[model samples]
Target: MDGYRGFLGLLVSALLVGFLSVLFTLIWVLHYREGLGWDGSALEFNWHPVLVVTGLVFIQGIAIIVYRLPWTWKCSKLLMKCIHAGLNAVAAILAVISLVAVFDFHNARSIPNMYSLHSWIGLTVVILYILQLLLGFFAFLVPLAPLSLRAFLMPLHIYSGLLIFGIVIASALTGVTEKLFFALTKPAYSTFPPEGVFTNTLGLLILVFGALIFWIVTRPQWKRPKEPNSVLLQPNGGTPEGVEGSMAINFGKADSESNNEAAARKRNLPLDEAGQRSTL
Candidate 1:
């Protein structure tokens, strides 16, 4: 409660703005500049920015933060995991289709591929995003790795995800600007035409959304509180014997729990001399 007061509301508004802004930009592209479809025409290229912004950047943001939502607190950890994995999977599929759209458009027009900064960054982000999703699925979803392995990787995964998200948003912003210039050059983009203003505003909104997401996910105080008394239920409709602590966190280092009292003193979290987590 101490840490959640102001930030959650900020997250909700940020999410809405980010999502709507992306949707607006996609519509703007399809409606005014290039109508969306996959007929291997210039119009087909429009689908790339739309899907990458919506799926890779916007939808992916929600997937990463689903666990932080207040409504998810009472839900089982397994349920949240499923939601996370499923959202990410859908985002990845959309990203793939968007990439295909662009490549097809380029090939049809004899345009060389990966020439711009935006393309390079977008491709890199997608590759890394796919890798991250695969690793996360095996590590956290199935519990295939040792607790220590998951522990070491968890921080990396979170940090890399945030980084990838930022890069993707940045790339999308540049892409939007580029599209505005090339597609609306009848009056010139430097004159601050309506298209320019609208696209730039959409890009700025995406930036704001990315900032809020990073804040919500990385702020130490925003971390979900442990449910100390939650029982670990097994698949056989029975509680795991002698297992009576929060399974809220996945893949905590078992060896470290043995030392929570002695050496597990982390900022914003404390452990008693008995190795039990302190409520404070």
Candidate 2:
């Protein structure tokens, strides 16, 4: 199971890298066009390509949410299998979107609105992909493991989730801005300017909100008695778990006996029936 989870983590991490790479590339391409003062062609109404891929990415996000639901942890084997299938489907969709976006960017003559769609979809893919990976990794590590291991992975998972959320929110805001202002601005000029200050302000506000949420979620929590043992073992230090305490005690006793025996041997002490040191 650990192996399986590790493999899944690697898979999701790879997909995330691909999605982010393509997304950043698309952003750079847009900036390049803007710098060149290029009025790129309008978005085409080709539903066959964009809608199909977007639909898949959207489904992937929904699948991740279903898979990570708390109730799924205690779900039946059949249900677990279904959830696993959902995760795999997400991974598959992400892979397809990443491939299609790369090809579209490479072959296009000018900047396409589909690039914006790709970026948004890629963000959704990465956010959900990461969440699913962390949940799977934690679910595997938390059982039949020492508290120390759980302590190590728990905060990591939480912080990563918060980051994912921020990314998702940014992607959504960017999508809205690109659609409302970039797509409809020219046609709706009777109501507002093509590049309205309001849209930019909204985008900025979205970024600020995302940043605030990141800060809030990542802030340190005050130490409490009922807090889980893992929380205490954070780098800031709190308290260790009971099982960890027991392991420490047992290890200390073993180390003490070994040191005593070594001291006895150095002093040429008498031997016991088992040919071991009698005393130090």
Candidate 3:
């Protein structure tokens, strides 16, 4: 089972890398050929997809799977939780910057904001994402929320997270489609340019990557497991299950040794084996 999970993990990695590769290919072929900048230019618009792909798509997926990583098992749960929250925070920040860049570019061009289907869904998802981060932090990271509340909200958090991830990917695909339709003039926009093909491929990879990540995260078999004799950690220091099991086995061995010694003494044949006793 573990081996299979490991193989699945490799598949997930490949899918994620492919997603980023396709995304970068689109960006380079369509956007970066012009150059990148933060000021109010077409170049500035590139940040939106770059940050969304790097932070929301790539880093975000990595953040979601921190607990699933086998090496993380040795570390304290709280530590992993911290890394989880931190990665999420970084992604959220980048996503926000992406949004800002889009709005800024639109305003500079005297274009309307939140007017398109892509913008509507994108903005809503971003708002929901920020709220999700807040809920997660309070529920799991801090004692701000009651542990009961945290437990109650946890499943909802997981469910909503996967759903929102899907929504973001969908919005991104639409946004890319919209960009190709609106922005491109050269290479004849209607005649299926190379950039158009790459953009569609990027969108497909996003779906595949999202599915793989969602699968690995939700699968019960892939979840972290406590060993049979795994020790439980507590503030006051507790005895390990492995030590308890070992002690019981040692006690049984000692009892068997004592029993044999007593039987040998009772035989009283120079305290030797049956062969020596028979010879004597």
Off by over 4 Å in 2: 1-85, 88-92, 95-99, 102-106, 112-147, 189-280
The digit string of per-residue lDDT tens for model 3 on 1-280 reads 4777675666567565646744664566465347668898888888788788777777787788778777777776668889999998998999999999998898999988888999999889888989999988887887477444665787999998888888987887887788888766787568878777777677777777777777778778768775555443332332223345456556779999999999878887654677686888
TM-score of each: 0.80, 0.36, 0.75
For candidate 2, the C-alpha RMSD (Å) to the true structure equals 13.9
Error of 1 at 204 (Å): 0.7
Model 1, which residues run further than 4 Å from truth? 3-5, 229-280
Question: Candidates 1 and 2: which is better by lDDT?
Answer: 1
lDDT of 1 by residue, 1-280 (tens): 4556677687878779877877786778776765777799977888887788789888898887887787777777778889999999999999999999999999999989999988898899899999999999999888687555776798898888888888888888888877786787778889888787877888888888888888787776766665646554443432231133244333355646756755545532533433553443
Q: Could you report the Cα RMSD, in angstroms, for every candidate shown?
A: 13.2, 13.9, 9.8
lDDT of 2 by residue, 1-280 (tens): 2244543453454345334433433343343223212122222212212322233333333343343333344455346646655554555565555445544543564454435664666446565755556565445433444456666676765555555545555564555455455445445624665344444444454444444333332333311113122223342333355446456557779999999999988776444533663443
Which 10-residue span in candidate 3 carries the lowest summed lDDT? 232-241
Q: Give the Cα lDDT of each candidate.
A: 0.79, 0.45, 0.76
TM-score comparison, 2 vs 3, better candidate: 3
